[model samples]
Target: MRGATAWSSPIDPMAAEFQVPVYFDYLATFSWALSGAIVALRKRCDIVGVFVLALLTSVGGSILRDGIFLQRTPPVLTDPVYLPLITLATLLIALLHQHIIHLQVVDKLVSTIDAIGTPAFAVVGMQLALDAGIPLPGVILVGAVSSVGGGVLRDVIVREIPFILQAGQFFALVVLLACIVFLVLTLALQVATVHAAWATIGLFFVVRTLTIRYNWQTRPLLRDEDH
Candidate 1:
């Protein structure tokens, strides 16, 4: 498939066709890495742990996508720019985390990054799946995995419950919805892929941010007798 091989090298951000999506993927990687690094610091992990989480959180989804679905070399290993970019993000968080931790906006910043990165990765994964001729259901699954697989892995590594499994807040649900919308726009309505991707990313980011701002949450199936 076209996307299966596109990650071997950095593409020109200004190039037409796949430009915006590719660039968005890079930005999403850095955002995820930064978020992971911050979590590592908060968990009192050493530098190695910080780097490990940062790198994994940035590319774990892609790895899962390629390994399990595409059966290709994961971009995290082949793409020259991915590792260095993740390293830069990790370094920034590792060095400035102490100062940033005291800031009132830190939580907001993390939410903002996650909000942006989630849809960015999701749409990109959807596009790749389409290019690979994957069926609609499989495309949606790939997009969802590309969106939240990293966070799930990160939480597992830290011995915490995965955010998607937690009752509070919409996480993977947002990604699933975004993927569905993108597919509807591009497939059903026949919209251009790039335009649909951007629209999905913007809409997802806004909706995700609002969920965080309003503290929107899901309830578990069973009621707590004590409560």
Candidate 2:
């Protein structure tokens, strides 16, 4: 019974102390769900497909981060808010599909929303890993997975290559760099504050947005003739 009390504790100190991160986590979920729903619409999928993509895009990375990496219950199972939010996103997208499809800015808007979510999730994952006493590499891995895992799953499910594998946009690189910067600031430099976390997020958002706006891309490794 020595460790029983610790195991049965009802409140997690980390969860209670970080209200802002929790709020941003849910916001990221909604943003990611919206992106997936838009993709579903682009594919001419029905309402059910939209729901599936939304759910997957919103929670898929967290599922892997928690269930597979951390060996804990997935947040989608423990948190009641995720499903309702995803459902709401699906419904809203369905309602606005006609107008959304016609808007020339739709692609840019979706990309921006997705970019907003990436750094938030990356910070969340880094904090969680640090709290769990994971090592530096594991922390970075968790952060990267939390940021891009869901999008990768969404793309794979839709039969498209994952964005990270594509030679452009610095998408996955942004997540990795952000995570590394966060770990350096908070762990190595001993600056343990939410502000540091937000700084990392801001850096990621700006760099990612600039890359998108400028059409920056990694140089292609193989030319058509070389291949």
Candidate 3:
């Protein structure tokens, strides 16, 4: 007990640390894992390769994150439930890849999931860093990295342009908005972070869906060649 300030349990909403963040992290990580499986099989990888890609894509960034924060082995590896869940997700995607590709809502699903992942991961990262007593800006930086880390790794592994860099997309924009909402509500305004987190989720879903529906995009830098 450090003076009067004992570490609060995660069950307390106001507590700085949350235990189930790993579970949420799993959801955030699934897209990359599934994408790995899809791209691997598409590239004609063997069974070993598929699972290898799955494991790497799902947990690589988390491993790197833990290493960065000096946590050994990564929580996803130490935790028993996460691997099975990721395995199930990858298997489902592998088996149903055909159906997945054909879904008219597939684009929407990716957008929705990426939206959820941003706030979920970012808020969790922020809380973790805060619990460890890091400064706010550092917390924000780490949070942003956690929010998009796996997806960036996944895209690079699959030899595709990272979704964040792809023009005409809302991928990183969702995460950026999420991070801002988290930092503002939790740090600056001293409001309920959980509610603020969900607000970001709703905000991302609405804005992303609109962007997709309206074919929205920020135009590239102009050149004078045509003019």
Candidate 4:
């Protein structure tokens, strides 16, 4: 409980009851929206398409995880803040598309943002599943889904394969590992705190960065033609 006080209280209780986790959610949403917008611009999508993709990438995972999987209304549908945040992200991307597209650092920026968001969303999903009293496997599933489902949806919309199913990157695996680590710390060790969540996010970011740097990949099964 040492670091708990630093994260508990909202500055404006009347205006919004935003907590630390909600802040994480907002960060993840913004990062994913930016990535989606970049992809839309890369694909030569119209402004409408860019906005749609940004919205989908920002809130799509939460919708699938909470609404479809958990059988409840998603926060994006109910929360007033989320829509405005995504709208702002979309408009920023629209205005800066020309500059962003020409930048050599765009890929790195997207990858870094995605790396940061994935673990945050994964921890959020695990926390929700734990609060719902879901089983261990269910918690892990929801966590992974919450981390990558939006990116998958965005890629599918643009006719590209989901990054999780692709050959190179251990992106989804990092999310799963982060979920397991978080649950182990909170449930098994009984150390549930905001610090634990932050630790999980840090671990995930380190692992993901190493994976990308080393070009680590999941091994594929042998093809039929090999026989």
Candidate 5:
């Protein structure tokens, strides 16, 4: 991707693109927090644990992203959107827990939400890193790590290997692909940032869908116990 320098142009395409892919960041947080709450509740965790887990899962990524960028304290903390959303999703899961279990639709919802959430992260992470003037490789690494950072932390705290490492899914690949997408479009095509964001979101999700559909995963050779 063409690097956005001080003299690149008065217009900033990357800023525009940031807005487009950002919605997915919101959705991913909501779903991740909700999912954690559901799991915690299912395991009979206490009320405080439920809330803590929910917040960590949902807003964790953004907090890390914003901090790295030296942006304002995250809106997820001050804004009203996340708290209520987490609360509602958690309560609903708690109330409907029994009925939802063993329901194929629920399983599908979980899987779809998880699959969709992954790529949404890739765009957000890559964009943030690029905006911060990080190198592409660093941006890619940061993107992948930020994209799934919260989930990985949540799973570890709750005692589960994150989906990225298992489940035959190309979790990190999604973020890396997203980083490449942004770099290529911004640098090579010099496409406006917002348009690039739309493309990134579309492509990332499509790739993630294929990865899930085909059970695409890192090679088993990478899974040795000693590694």
Candidate 6:
């Protein structure tokens, strides 16, 4: 108790209308839409499918976050810019489909974009949860959902397993770690919210990029006898 960090005074709900920076939100939205559109193209989807996937992957997480947890209008609906951003992503994929598919850097480009968007959305969701006065566990949950919920929807629609549910790179795990680190920094260490968010995002990006570079993977809890 002697060494415990003092909890900050309660935040006023009215004053708690926290916002993720416009640039961060829009950049992440576009990156995710681009990733989704690429996947749609790889699956041989038509232009309509590209748009559908782009829209879902760009906004599905925020939809789940607001509708289920925050219980408010999702920013994709309230903000005028989000849809246009997704449309731009779709158009880019539409016009450059052949070039993108043939580029040697496509994999690396998608990985880089994913690394950026994942932490960005996680931080955004974590901030929203903190402003809403949710419990710490709920905050982590919101962050993970906001990071991967869109990909889950896209995968399901395409009849493939969701990345979060699969034993692959540390996607949801990284998000959870990021959210926990943010809470520890802001709540326990008393760091400023913006600084803590940036630190967490940086940490997540570094760890995620390293894992991808090294082919670090999660193994099955129970291995199959055939293997």
Top candidate when judged by lDDT against the true structure: 6
lDDT, candidates in the order shown: 0.81, 0.81, 0.65, 0.78, 0.69, 0.82
Clashing pairs in 4: none
Per-residue accuracy of model 6 over 52-157 as CA lDDT, tens digit each:
9999998999999987877767878877889999999999989988888888697687778778788788888877776666777888899889889999999999
Clashing pairs in 5: 1-183, 1-187, 2-187, 13-193, 17-193, 17-194
**Superior by TM-score: candidate 1 or candidate 3:** 1
Model 2 lDDT on a 0 to 1 scale: 0.81
- Tens-place lDDT per residue, model 1, 87-205, is 89878887788799778687677678778888888877777676666778998999899888898999999999898887888777888889999989988998877888889989998
Global Cα lDDT for candidate 5: 0.69
Question: For model 4, what is the alpha-carbon lDDT of residue 172?
Answer: 71
Tens digit of per-residue lDDT, candidate 4, span 1-94: 1222323342122121122357767878988888888888888989888889998998899899878886656889877988889888889989
What tens-digit string does per-residue lDDT give for candidate 5 at 1-227?
33356223333434634465555656777788777776677667877778778877777776776555425355577656778888877777767777876677876676577666765666666665666566778777766765677777778878888767774667676677777887788777988766776687678778877886898867776566868
Write out the backbone clash pairs for model 2. Answer: none
lDDT of 2 at 120: 81
RMSD of each: 3.9, 3.5, 4.6, 5.5, 4.3, 4.7
Please list the residue runs of candidate 2 whose C-alpha ends up more than 4 Å from where it truly belongs after superposition.
1-20, 225-227
Error of 1 at 54 (Å): 0.3
Q: Clash number for every model? A: 0, 0, 0, 0, 6, 0
- TM agreement with the true structure for every prediction: 0.89, 0.90, 0.77, 0.88, 0.79, 0.89
User: How many Å off is the CA of 47 in candidate 2?
Assistant: 1.2
Residue range with the least summed lDDT across 10 consecutive positions in model 1:
10-19
lDDT tens digits, residue span 177-209, model 2: 888898788767877658777788789889988
How far in Å is the alpha carbon of 126 misplaced in model 1? 1.0
Worst 10 residues of 2 by lDDT: 1-10
User: Can you list the residue pairs that collide in candidate 1?
Assistant: none
